[model samples]
Target chain A: MGGDFHWVATEPSGAGRDILPADAVLFGNGRQALYAVLMEGRRRFGWRVCHLPAYICQSVVQAARAADMECRYYRALPAADESPDWPPFQSRHEVLLSANVLGFSGLDLVPPDWPNENRIEDHTHDPWSRAACESRAGYCLVSLRKTLPTPDGGAAWSPLGLPCPSPEALIPGHAAAGQEKLAAMLLKRHYLSGMAVEKEEFRAWQIQSEAAMSIQPTSRPLPVTASMLPHLPWRRWRVERARNAEYLTDRLLGSLTAPALEPDRREVLPPPTPRRFPEQCPFAVVLLCRNRRERDRLREALIQRRVYPPIFWPLPEEAARRHPEAADFAARMLALPCDFRYTPEDLEEAAEVIREFFQTEAG
Target chain B: MGGDFHWVATEPSGAGRDILPADAVLFGNGRQALYAVLMEGRRRFGWRVCHLPAYICQSVVQAARAADMECRYYRALPAADESPDWPPFQSRHEVLLSANVLGFSGLDLVPPDWPNENRIEDHTHDPWSRAACESRAGYCLVSLRKTLPTPDGGAAWSPLGLPCPSPEALIPGHAAAGQEKLAAMLLKRHYLSGMAVEKEEFRAWQIQSEAAMSIQPTSRPLPVTASMLPHLPWRRWRVERARNAEYLTDRLLGSLTAPALEPDRREVLPPPTPRRFPEQCPFAVVLLCRNRRERDRLREALIQRRVYPPIFWPLPEEAARRHPEAADFAARMLALPCDFRYTPEDLEEAAEVIREFFQTEAG
Candidate 1:
């Protein structure tokens, strides 16, 4: 449970600048924010087609589909040390949605010539990263719940000083769901503190919260999230996450075999360091195995050692069919827990498990 | 804040029978439960028109409207000691939805000859009453959150062992909203215990929760609510409520003016007794003012004394036009809080405030 990437209540410290932009519109969750942004584009510019990365979370894909946008898949995840191959686009009618994937790298992903008016950048993985702050996309969004201890929060902002779609008053059901998640986060803190709390207790609330969020696609952020945002220690979290991710990457560097990835798929990218990128935080320490079989074997071994890592995503069927290389990347990728939850010592223990797996168990 | 009827976390004690029937389906809130039932009726029995009480909460009206049911107004309150006059029905196609208002008296409301298949009894005001338990209606529903400290809960059951409509999994937004309410309840307990908590802190959450519940008309109850229900001391709460209500009624009996009422308009019903009706609990101590002006005056006076009793409802514009007697009753009736939150001593202080308002302040 200590190594599992579950939510826990983080104590608030000194006040900082608001995590989100002043003009950003808030929503109950990221999918709602994305859907609202897409619908706004359709309303304002008659946008119909949405170009998305095939190697992405299903939630992004679902948001586009829910907006009734025609989706076109594009390949992401370039080979080692190469830039992503940016595709040519027509006009504002065809919107592009790209994510700052894992917050590891993003500087080269944005094509300078791409129309900012037709782009939406997602920084859900790491909103504190430089990529998010410097994004030139028409719209930028972040799912704050992913990074912060808040139960529900999604913010969509216009980086180009354009108007963003504002959500109406939150529906009570959505607010209630958010509150449930908040309770879960608090319960998790108790569980983590060695209290007589069942792991399933928080997990059940979390699962229910997710189901409720999926049902209500659009709503304003809960009042608690709004009030709690400024109080969250974002800078500390950023540096801590960076240290953890970097420590894990360093520990695994020699032990992990260089994955024989396909031409379009990349080997793992080392996490950003706090020294190089003070504001940036890696979403996780990315680990890529030689194949899907090896990835699963390693994942199971890590789980046995109580170091639970998550697959970034399993590709959707259509995405898998359309972009085989992205699908291949998905099969091999495992995101180790590298957020502010653990210290370098904890990562060292995790590193020992990983070394044991690769040196003694993995083929 | 001491006299205010806000939520507080109640400590769970010994296990009792589940508050809801085993076969009953749960929902995020009362409106959702009612809406789902109406929709189910439409799907099964081709039920079109729904007859509702003229004197009712807006939530009940909205639920019917959301379900697209044709609503008909029925006279619910009768002269003192007289029964509610049941109107002629047109088979099961014209469904009747009636509430056992305040749970003070309900045995006389049901027309013995009416078809049980067409009746939907709302026991939200007091679900544990003998009237609710012994009802011959086809369906009976209660909004548990109204009585229990849980954030959100609505249960629709059948007295005749008939099948009921089942709610789908809770939407994450709604579940989150409920969780928010739950958090508010816990915070409220701290506030009540003389902690330095701002009143606005919990009120904001409660307001947000209500908004979310309104937006989502249907979903299964949050798992927290389901788990918390059995542990709640319903029997003790019921007894305490009865005691508080009875003591308040005993004190206010002579101070209250028996209004020169119309034959259609009834005098206030005294709180039910624990000795005579062990399972029954009065929703509140009902007081009928001489007029709207006097009612408003007394309400303000109580607020000055830090007692915040809510108006059961204000008549909808259309309902006011259709039922003058019910509209007048809504304007004049005040429900004094008599829940488990207050002791007899607390009620005595509230009673003193009420008596002073009538004795010296009244015109």
Candidate 2:
């Protein structure tokens, strides 16, 4: 399992040399990387952080609160066609967290003129490539567990600079424990479907143990271990994901409106494109329902059928009252599954179920 | 799976012979039942909830806070010739939650002068027969998932005059979904072993789904399903638990003391006595450490070895400061496992490990 696979940005073609210079990379699991930046931003830079809306879980909000930072939500503007009335930056020393929404939309909507002291791009949705190219203060964080086979791995890279803590600083036996836990989690996820939901608790336990294992007074730059970068069948994963998404989209199109994706923009990647976006990465198909009530009804119906669609992140009542447009959009949105796990046939079946539900109602 | 075992009680079969009549049964899983009765107590009956000091977990305190109740801690007054406190009911409650403290001490500790309104027993711990009798509360709650194979089953029974909702009043398909979720949880717990730690997400998902499924119109009582009650191997479970407790107690006698019990006070039962004096149900062996630091250190060490020993419940910092003696007692207490899952050999092995730990420290 140690030397099984290696993560290649692009498959080596004896044609060109690797161009990216290595900076201080802070390796972590998905949420860990997110928190690392949040903690760093507040402690080191004293920047106030504002998060994007409808992107992730309330745990992220709780994490922000844990860091004693105020969280302000901004709606994800509709693909290149519509630009949001972006709120004024309250402070120049503010930090913006541009989360990769459903792993598809972030690259296209990187706010061009946003002024901030630092920017943390979260690639938990898709860690294959960096979403944001340049920023006043750019630090991209990637959670490997979401997209890759590795049980636990996360990396924070900064083109500007990185404050890499040394390996000596790491808790003793942490890497081994982490690897073991990751293996256990992956095994349970694949072999025992019943145990998949328990992954969060396992991760929490790992976090606690890892925290305990951290050694004080450290000064060795911890190199990302080869064990962390296992070979991921990105091409195969991407192809299946795209097919599933397309199938679901076509099936749901009659009754549910899938979120619009701009066709003009090509995905940001290196030349030769070992990974084809059209064939590989179709993250999620966000559907717009008739109303909040309808969306909730659809959710409940799907849940009864053992299909758990993503939940709507309820906005704080005050925020909703202040931003009616955001509130309305949040209510109507429902993110459907379109990952490597589901097949095209599964998507078609799901779509059929959705169609029949609405068709029966219409009749 | 449904008809594989038999049900037994401590007392002679009476009028409600076919179906056991539970007085104010607490429903939901172990944690939820504890929360429902203890946490939710303040809202229904203010200032009557008195919690024991020797319990495990901080969530209980959180539950109490959520229910707008204050927790009053009591010292576990040790019996004559015992160094450590036994059957810790040092304080009185108008509404006492009879937690089957590791299946033993709870029954005997129901004070002779206990007020009738003061007995809300939590059968989550032992859940055998007599523990139910210890509570004279109008209502009692049982976490069905803990003892039975059912995925989700909870009962609220009242001994005093109160209207019990008829079977016709239960929500449609509520029991089925709850059972399925509970089955999934139990299966994961049994088969996955360590993976059970990670199942929080799945449990949360199940909780959300169950909550949705159980919503009934306030117009009528939801119907209770007959299939919810299955024959559990109470006798076998009790015997195994008692064996394990005895094994550990013998090993820890010199170093740590078991909770005391009066031998002559044991009650008769239908088959397996549900209510046991300290001698009868002695599986859960709780010991008082030197201090909170020692207790926490031991807990951490045990966790590192992939062995979890229950520590005393966390006292609120404010409360601890206010009641130093109670805090001191809490800091020193640790509960050893004595579940039916452990055989005599397993209990011996666990005891040996614990003995070795203390012995090595002493040397």
Candidate 3:
């Protein structure tokens, strides 16, 4: 072993020094960042209730609750076969949260005429969605921790040109979360440097850190994370993921089914939209199963080959029980790992795993 | 200065080492810790809606909201004369939150038989409350930042034997917050060592750090905070506050009103209970005003003298509009700082200031 590998900032961009407008700010998590905007709106404009898509995560719901805003859902997913409808506008309705559900999928953007001040674009799942960057709303929220190797951070900026909240300082537990991540990086480096690494201990720390993050009180990003996030080669990552997603999409074209029990396979491929954001980041290569059974079977088949997929959400029981469509959506929506971590070969291997599952199951 | 003030841990005891049971956990703030318990209850026990005291802070409401718990208020304060009534319970109701309002004064313990599993005791205002340590209910939350010099910490325990989640890792923002606090401590030490301290810059950092804390996401106590908190002379501080509360109580026994515009001053003070948990800690020396006019006048008077008091809570519009009783409660409650930082002479000065204000107003 030559020497210890340095692991401090992930992106080397020194993002903290990036000359951004007062409109941009960093928060502990995407939810906190979005919640800040909602809080600001409620505090300044007396906004009480908000409109959100029924197809959403609990974090989004909790963020609004944190801001003490009453939520009423409007259909926004492509699965809901109806013209996108906005919830009936009321004076009490202060904001409309238009979420980019999956980076490459989900409903089209809400009309520009929809109240801008009342809009907070939730770009948690898809930072590459059109509204993800140039938020036409009062706030744009992006959860980048999952996208990047950094421990905890989310960014929010006002598209309406409102000043953003100042970045908050880190408390202890938050720094520890980031520290654990840094430690993991160090361990990997030590092994690469031909030093003995306690892989099991590193894994234990990884699990512990993940558990800690789940319940840790939301706060601003670590100073290290702030600098790292911006330095990321975002354009390259976005392009790569887009290409990977496209490859997977084309392979599975005519083979995927809408989340339904009757197995209504989508035979015709939807015309691919031109990527407006040069840095089009794809969170996952999402695929729909014909039913819950098919989804489970395909998931099991993939895992056996060391192929892991992310269940975007388990669809909290409450959400499922209240909205049956959400349950159906949760049961059928499967996300393939097409993150920057994967290569073209890896994508092909993952696609082949799926093809094998469907062929065997059908036969 | 003779030497640099070695500033790191807040409590000299090296607190983080304290062995705690699985039932208890420390968090970044009391509200966040309490919120975790609420989340657990809602997730595990199907607690959808809860009844809280209308006379409460936004933090409590927000905590419950953060857990997606619908709240219904039952009169817990002294406004209604009869024994406190619990809101009508339904199967969906998972828990009822009982709060210890002011550090020194508020409601008595909820009836012992009041479904222990369904109760979460908020000991934020009074950690010395009987429920503070051996939580007889599902959860007992205490906000301790105001009690000690530690930058931030709160604790909650499940005496009902509920399993507590593992502690989380710290992110950068929290560590930064702690660092800022450590810097302030160093400055204070420098000044104490007979040095010409830059008080303005110190105040700027203080203000900046405070703002940092406000926006920082809630998480478990930083490694430093957790360690510093346990090392604190908790027992001594607790006794001092109790002594202070009694002294203030004796001086103005009949002066406090029942937090109303139309005064409901209790002519007879409740009998003081013997401190079983000898380490009795009080968040503040609370004083009720005869009316909103009187409360504001006293607050202004104290501020002019550089003696700041906490305004317990500024009732949220939603809370105030729905619960008028809470708004009235907010208008009249005033809290005087009686933490360990203040001496007996300091208490005497504060009392005199209050006495002078009322006397001058009447004159």
Candidate 4:
């Protein structure tokens, strides 16, 4: 939860969409937000949910385990050719959870007139997207921590108008140590390079928190996390992120003689029309490589330069069998970073580095 | 690890002795140096080992578990006396690791001829003692970290001339991280209230070290840590420890009408021993309270004044079935601080507190 991050806010899309009733559900930390939603379908509705995006952390799988649900990967369609071929869901599944890939392409992927028993949308990747706001789903979960510089926070809203349980029931000791951990994280960030030292301190805090959890009498209901969430530097963060991504994309297109884009088959989300502000959360420039090796090589090169971009969804094999298209996309796709941390100049340098590697390989 | 209190060192005992082969074994970080000897046992005698201790922190348990061994614990023993009856070991247990009641009484409760493939002695408490210096059927492990400011170090020696594995087999990652942790602990001691911060950092480092061990490639055999290890502030650490224990003991006896020493059960080792160091590691000054509640109340009082002491070892009923004598000792035992951190003045004040509690209770 400790990171230098930003968030973008938009006017709430009011309630009154397609609705479905839900029973008890569980929530997870930021990284597993999507998986938590997907697993909930399997848990409550006995839906053998499968075919999720491949690229994600182990925590996502763990969330499923926590809920006693099984997960399988889905294939991602290539960005250039977005002909969506999703795996068939079992008729018995009353719920489906879908994600907008990196905020770039959502509509091209989702099936029109999708069955909506307990459709849940995840807003972790693109919180400011109108897709979530306009979705005709029963519920949606948002990972506030991913977008903001807060230690931990999340929200789940139900279109069915089901009220949330009291905050005490959700996370009993949430407030007891959240503030202290936040403070410790802040202190640790001050000495970032002193990772060894910082990690030690952070771990101690974690142990204490764990101990507190163990000793807590029983699970108490929590209405919601009520502390004031930090306001994000939306405008500046968005502008810089877009500018960087665009600059890098342009340079890569000019220098690399690879399959640049298949405009006929691909559909990029139109520039976000900022609702509350002139700018919004920047979307990544996702590239679908011709093969997996090229993507891996490019990823390695970028890491060597200390520029890590989010790559392939970790679609498990079982999920891939369900969503072959998603599996294919995951194998060839790579995401380039376009965040507030980089500037135009940094993008130019990154582009040149990529160009040199590909040109040398071709020669 | 974080506490608001400080311990002061007592005057050094001028007498010198060869504190080698320790008396018993402890499992955790502050375990006596004799563990090195046991690790050698693993190498020399491919014995499938099982360590008996509380299922506590990961680092301590990991050391044994990492070796592909298992650790078992005696269930919580209720207090009936100063010590619980020693529990019967599973037939498979080759070694029994025991400790001096937090620097109070040695493992004199266990009969001299307890059945075990070997008896590993841990001498964190009074590391200078020679009573159990000879390894009856097993080696002794001694931890130097508890007594000295060393970052990481321990030794295990045997009187039976058992061959040990090379020290090279000791996982390097753990040793290195342990050194760093030791340095941090030393630095953190200078500050109050931030002990938790430092301890947390140490725990993380410990975890990383353990993880590193999991992936390390199998290598050449490690050498056995020997008894003839070079001196490292042994005289100074032991002298200060004994002086502190004696200082507090004198004050408690003078202030309280009841005798501090249980004359009927006393088993004092002769002074001026040649094999062990003249000074002892003053880990704690254990006291025999009348009952569990009294000990708990006394501990609470000490904690209120920021004078923290080691926790009392509870003797469960199962333990009583095995070593009935231990049950009696477990109930009335409390260990006071006697580490090098405590000064004469601190000891005096601590003794006064203990005396006041008992005096008021007697009235």
Off by over 4 Å in 1: A1-17, A42-49, A65-70, A78-80, A89-93, A169-218, A254-268, A271-274, A304-307, A343-349, B2-149, B152-296, B301-307, B310-363
- The Cα error of candidate 3 at residue A218, in Å, is 5.3
Query: Per-residue alpha-carbon lDDT of model 1 for A228-287, expressed as tens digits?
Result: 566578787888888787777777775654343232332445632335565456777787
Which is superior by TM-score, 1 or 2? Answer: 1
Worst 10 residues of 2 chain B by lDDT: B1-10
In terms of lDDT, which candidate is strongest?
1
Fraction of native Cα contacts reproduced by each candidate: 0.21, 0.00, 0.00, 0.00
Flag the better candidate by TM-score, 3 or 4.
4
Q: Which parts of model 2 have CA positions greater than 4 angstroms off?
A: A1-124, A129-138, A142-155, A159-240, A249-280, A285-336, A340-346, A353-363, B1-102, B105-125, B131-157, B162-240, B249-280, B286-335, B340-346, B353-363
True-contact fraction in model 2 equals 0.00
Candidate 3 lDDT, A1-363, residue by residue in tens: 101122332323433333223456877767777677777778777889887777777777877887888877776654424444566556645678876666544435554456777777777666655545555777777776665555567778887887676444565566555555544443443433334445454455456655555322457665445545555665565677677777776676534442322246422112244543343345666677877787888788887876767665676776677667767767876777665666778878877787666666665
lDDT preference between candidates 2 and 3, better one: 3
Model 2: number of backbone collisions: 40
User: TM-score of the candidate numbered 1?
Assistant: 0.59
lDDT digits (tens) for residues B9-72 of candidate 2: 1212222222335433323333344445553444444545565443433544454455555555
Q: Sorted on TM-score, highest at the top, how do the candidates line up? A: 1, 4, 3, 2
For model 2, what is the error of residue A267's alpha carbon versus the real structure, in angstroms, after optimal superposition?
18
Q: What is candidate 1's CA lDDT for residue A131? A: 78
Instruction: Name the docking class for model 3.
Output: incorrect
